[model samples]
Target: MTLMHKILGTAAAFALSAGAALSEPAMIYDLGGKFDKSFNEAAFAGAEKWKAETGETYREIELQSEAQREQALRRFAEAGLNPIVMAGFAFGSILEEVAADYPDTKFAIIDMVVDAPNVRSIVFSEHEGSYLAGMMAAMASKTGTVGFIGGMDIPLIRKFACGYVQGVKAANPDATVIQNMTGTTPTAWNDPVKGGELTRAQISQGADVIYAAAGGTGVGVLQTAADEGILSIGVDSNQNYMHPGQVLTSMVKRVDVAVYDAFMSGADLETGIFTLGLAQDGVGYAVDDNNAALVNDDMIAAVEDAKAKIISGEIVVHDYMTDNTCPVK
Candidate 1:
């Protein structure tokens, strides 16, 4: 080939490479709404952090219905989004179905696993964080009883409940835990009215501390707890500030970190199951000014010691999703 022709060929290849690099990352939020102040919000925070740091925008979609999952995934892939990040387990089947159609596209999913060469499944050790939160709830329960409000009656939600119950039992074996599920559908995650009613029922059963793993529904749980003058726990994000002194603490799962890392990794992001546990700083209980006075030195110390043991493999929080049974309840 002539020298000029060779130079032109190389220039064309460079242009194609540059175009691929410029393709923005994308995210599809779960059904509870992007600003649900829980799971979806955490993912949003991560995407915003990436935008702020890199000054690059990303495509985003908030799923309003279950039917939208497959459509959203296909649209993003067809548009050539380098890496599409999803925020919930509900997207698992859809991701798997759509992933096969776009073999070259990289996909990242949080809280669920999609077995595909091009998909990155990010699951967190929520049981570990829930255990810590349970410890605090048990310690702070003046009534010798605590409560757990789950969004859906799924195994993942049960895992959260099981972990919390174990922590509560570890701290106070005699402590009573009252558990309730909002519903068995996606709407369960966003129904604050139902959550408030459930909180009232738990309080009637002598619960003084409540931990909510119900996404947006948790907002109602926190509000009712605050209004009723009881301690409550948050989840997914650091939501202690939601009710300040009324909130005891939050079981923080670093979904934000997972999303941020996926975005930063870009086209070269790793594919496969990425599990985040105490060892990876993927999950923990939050302590901030919102509830600083509520978390005593002893409480903090005990949780820290437990955290260390968990990291060292001395403690294993039971994941209910594994066998669908909780040792504590």
Candidate 2:
């Protein structure tokens, strides 16, 4: 979609906004939205950045129901915003159609690849971050088994699970990795009830640490951990405060970076792909309030080393949807 450009000398540019700025930094979120604290919340953080950077007011349209996804995209595009951004891979189809329909409005979708001239699709190599988390899970587990709870059984979530399992195997050959999904649909991302139940099930099956990439559902998983006296890892955002000392670590996606950079890149260049990975400082593990004491500095150092390898093209993290695992690399 072609983004609407303001008058060359008009309005507050991102680089120069002596006025009150755009006054409307808008974001369109996929199903889980704000409270999810995983996908949508990260985008909200970006909105916060936009507010901080331009002094422009930002608006967010959250999709509470799956059916509303397309509608939300259309409404945001019709709102005549500069760049209408969408979060989550599940919104790929909706974003494509919406961008096509609103050619004058530039569109950016996170976690998905859309090959449109006017759309800047930003994707993160989540596997690399997940691998480090997987390694940590293995090292911290006393049961020799770690659990993975995903929001949905989609290919994107699967990519996270696959990378995690492989990392655990590479770190501790003897450890077993358990995987479970919150549900089959998008609402699964917000259903904490299912998330808590799944975490308990994994624990019952001898899981020592649970890694959750289940959006809002992850909150429930952490709640289970705190109540059950087990360990849990968070995704997307730094959720260490959710469970304090019990919530081990979090794989930070830096969605805030992606959103702000995309806006700047879109303003600077017309079209291209922006792949934010470890090298770009787009993804990493968080060392915050809860995890400072539990995580070893050496482990963080090891992740940095792995990050360097990936950045230099030495360690290749494969995505299940794009790469085949048949030959077992």
Candidate 3:
């Protein structure tokens, strides 16, 4: 049984009746919908995996607006949902406000930290994975220029860009990187048109490989890169299959693992700040049958060596969140 609900208006949109079973886990997806083929979709995959393995049903809701954040959290908690998982960093403040109200209802939020005892904050070292993707992009680029387009213009996305530029410089110091952000608002996460425009603009500037850290917007980046006969890198999910040979690689963030672990823990979920990085397989680049021919043996060797060095602390990828500044432009 899968109780998937799409909340378009107020909290009243959630149809979970009071008679529903208590202690069941729930998931709340951020904007861009669950099928945006990016971040939220990866989280949905985790919930589906849990359902497939345990034959248990979990409640899920796709948020339609920023105003629905607190409403949805309260609705689920009031209905006795335990260990509710939210898929984006935007939920941090709301979770902080609501976690205290529901002492027995454990809550888990990804990509942000809430200092509450019953709230589990899971963050990832996205910079590390983006670095590896950068290496692949630099090595695969024929024009000596790559581009990065991000969504929401936040420190988190900057972290991705910064790491990528570092890796590109490490691979080819002469390589040029062009970076852009979709927007400052939440709508940026779902704007594929803007993503496409940015990709084309970068292409005009001599970029042959591009990386998209935007959410649904990345779909446009990948599609435009494919249509233009250039290489693109994906974020937060294995998006190589989306464009096959046209996608150089993807910075695969283990958002599914975070959701799966939260659901598997049930009501007894531990509450604390958990960080996932290259050392813990929390982030990586994807190489599958779809794009295996694109990444050759030398590219693999160089990326793997960097991965090991990053994990061993020998290579410190600057974290933009630390000082809100990237070492390289």
TM-score of each: 0.92, 0.85, 0.90
Clashes of each: 0, 2, 0
Q: Root-mean-square deviation of each candidate, in angstroms?
A: 5.5, 5.0, 4.8
> How does each model score on lDDT?
0.91, 0.77, 0.90
Error of 3 at 216 (Å): 1.5
Q: Identify the candidate with maximal lDDT.
A: 1
Candidate 2 to native Cα RMSD, angstroms: 5.0
lDDT of 1 by residue, 76-177 (tens): 777667799999898888888899998978999999988999999999999999999999999999999999999988888899999999999999999999
Displacement of residue 110 (Cα, Å) in model 3 is 0.4
Off by over 4 Å in 3: 1-22
Return the clash pairs for model 1, or none.
none
Score residue 271 of candidate 3 by CA lDDT.
Answer: 90
Leading candidate by TM-score: 1
Residue 183 C-alpha lDDT in model 3? 93
Candidate 3 local accuracy as lDDT?
Answer: 0.90
Any residue pairs clashing in model 2, and if so which? 2-104, 3-106
**Candidate 2 per-residue lDDT over residues 1-329, each given as its tens digit:** 12244323223353375422342335777666576687777888777776787665555777778888887777655554556677778788777777778776677778888888878878888888888888888888899999999988888788888888877876788898888998887788889998999988899999989999988889899999889988899999998888889988988898877776655543232544677777776777778767788888777776678778877988777767686351121
Q: What TM-score does structure 2 among the candidates reach?
A: 0.85
